[model samples]
Target: MNARTADAPAANPTSAPAGTLLHELSSSPIAESLRRELLKRWPSTPDRVREISRYALLAPGKTLRPLLLVASADAVGGSYDGVLPAAMAVEYLHVATLIHDDVIDDDELRRGQRSVHAHYGMADAIVTGDFLILTMFTSLAECVERGVPAAAVLEAVRVLAEAGADVCRGQTKEAELTSDPSSPIADYETVISLKTGALFRGVCRAGAILGGAGPDHTEAVTRFAEHLGLAFQMYDDLLPYLWEPGTTGKPNTSDAGNLRPTFPVLLGYESAGRGDRERFTEALSGRIPAAEAYERLRELLESTGALHRARARAETEAALAREQLAGLPSSEGVGLLAAVAELSINRDR
Candidate 1:
């Protein structure tokens, strides 16, 4: 599925294409309600923080995290009426990360537009990110007002708060690994798990808790989310090699420019001969221009079969994600979750 903002309804979900399925899921009444609540909770204001936040929150992209939260709740027989605030909370947390991440990575674009830092200056972006971080907790707290147990809301807060900390540690670890080009595949796995998988697992587990699911089902969904997140990050690393910025919605050279040791680059380097290794190291160190590094890495990744290997790993993770679904009862939400697993590896943007 592509990361298009506009949501469309599906006439026949069973027979619809993957993109349509995504649009259908995103346009569901519950999802619409979440959108309304988001707009209502954070209405237009003259304050710069509020203005920037409104832009960031309503940006053109797939609302995947919140959708996952709500869908997980539905899968376990929970109604949206009780889970909307929590869903909003996850999305706020996600956008906050994106804002801070753009600044840290020096990325100029996000969701097909100028990144928060690039468009709004670094100081404002940082402050806006902090505001959103605090806002996420308050949003989660509103779950109790919607009839969710205070205990469940508190637990969800703990889960997401830890997940946020994990993201920071992962970012730190990634920065450290950049100096060691030969960091093992296991290290890459660990980084992505903490950076990407942690929040995914948090949202799914929190959703299960809000839905009143038993421990077994909650564990299963958490595992599913973790594996899916890993696959998502793997595929995300491949997009620059497979498509242009116009298609991917972000600059294709951001990873190379930032000297990120993405999975594809690492795999290609590991399988490469001495000559290829030197070239890759030079490209990684920004000795070459970003566009050149991007092209060179793509060629090397293709030649060394690293691209194929990375894809295979993503497929394996997607399969693992699907396997966890068996623990949950059959429902529309479960089916949507399975489709999301499929989307992780197959998405173009």
Candidate 2:
């Protein structure tokens, strides 16, 4: 909500279209495939557990991680059959993370509906998330049954396990920052690199390995994922500050409400003039009431050019991600992957 600066580009209609296409691609095949895989390999007997598991698992998530995994396989001329189990496993893993995230954030809504924890109670939600993670490993085991080599499957398992560890570390660091708001910029980067970027890099690497990609192509996809993940998460952090809460399908004030130091807030802090910085810090410390605090943040971001600079950083990451696609062969698969990088910056929600 800055003054319409010449530096700020108009909302891109093309980016929305790319998002739409990506949405369509993420659903249909991935959803149907995952549904079958989960049903086949589901490891629950309690009727209630099954019901809540389906409730959380079948929610309208983007399935972006699975899209990358399956699409990477396609890009290498590998049949979906070889990677279908791994693809389903990645989808389950991502959904598991979302359920746990909502609980950690104490978020009320997800995908425009009541969050699993909100509707089902905390214990049930926790169990549901754990079940999904359990099923993820089961699905990974099925990958070998689907003709994936044992060595490749083992490596993919190692990558995913490491990423899971990284996510936990990231969350721990984020907690530390939330409690003490003076965290450095480098701390934010490290937290994000583990929490968000690790999964992106791991899944893409897992996909490439499953697809039998050469070492060079696998490395290329890894870099592509790293760039895209940082930009995607930063854009997510910017959404509440830039647009309405409903626009992003979550509570807008959650970060400020929790006093979390997001990238934009931290950037705004660095860029603000001395007086504005003091005012912003007081706002963060809750000297200002909630509603007034948002106003102050908006003013600081606008006058100090922090939001614009954050947007520019995200665009740079997207550009770098697109460049990584050059190492892959030309195909519709590669094109959609490239379009995803474009969609990352253009996305409004």
Candidate 3:
């Protein structure tokens, strides 16, 4: 990670002369709206918790999960306004998990800045995370008030709760695995899928439900979200090794101290390198055939073939997601969904 200016904006694909998957999905209005909403619900009970919550929630991030919710809603031709609460809820839930995750990982930094625990102390960070988790439920209650249908709200809550549990499980597994140096790649991936993919799946499911899709559509969206989430995490796995200063918003060698089960470390330098290439090739080779943007995504992954295998797995999942959406009505939101799938796998930061 490179030292970036404190107020520097997250890397944008075009402005930075780097290609990231999120470029096509960027929506300032949507992101701003989400921030405002999250701020409105910042912990108000305890002043200390409020401050801690603000620091964590207001941190710089791409807001990918919310974007996914909004895009998924759009894919079904639903109004963004209608889905805003759910989107916010998903983001809040995600932030809550991050707060807890930082504590568990004992990570000192996040998004190139001190993590909540580092800035506010561990006890306060835990309280802050708990507050955020409860606030997410409150947000969900508000969704019910907004006429999103009780069932839909409940479904989202259920997915979120299950995901939360899965994340905890993943964390436990990781803790055990990391203690021993012999953790297998498959084991690492399993933890990632549960820890990371679960929330992503929830994001998609919430969107599909809010969009008023049928059972089949919901199932398909779930599949798409699961694969997309896996891809997203796979990309994240690569970041710890490949991150650059000013580009990744953190120290280039930040993960070196952690000694976690990252792709490069697990596969070793040579085999990991070859795996990335082969995975990307398989990902785009009709294994999970997608539509128009698939080729563009494939090209992007291939170009960055240094991490091709991880990228390819992500692409394959995105491809599967695209296929899941095929039967749904075509709309601009759908296009956004497709773009988001590409973005999740191809982002540089």
Global local distance difference test of model 1: 0.83
Candidate 2 on 174-262: residue-level lDDT in tens? 88887333568889988999899988888888988888888888888889899988988888788887777766778887777667778
> What is the RMSD of candidate 3?
10.5
lDDT of 1 by residue, 207-302 (tens): 988987888888888988999999999998988888789778789998888888899889988989999998888888878888998888788899
1-349: candidate 3 lDDT, tens digit per residue? 0111122122222222226334433444565566666678665555778777777777877778887787676666566666777777787788889888778767777776888998889998888888888887877677767667888778878877888888888878776655233357788778888888888888888887887778887787788887777777777766644546555655443333333445534443334346554543343334443332233333443455446566566667767766666766644555556666666656676
TM-score of each candidate structure, all chains considered together:
0.93, 0.88, 0.78
Better of 2 and 3 by lDDT: 2
Distance (Å) between predicted and true CA of 21, model 3? 5.2
Per-model tally of clashing residue pairs: 0, 0, 12
The model with the greatest lDDT is 1
Model 2 lowest lDDT segment of ten: 1-10
Query: By TM-score, highest first, what's the ranking?
Result: 1, 2, 3
Global lDDT of each candidate? 0.83, 0.75, 0.66
Q: List the residue pairs that clash in candidate 2.
A: none
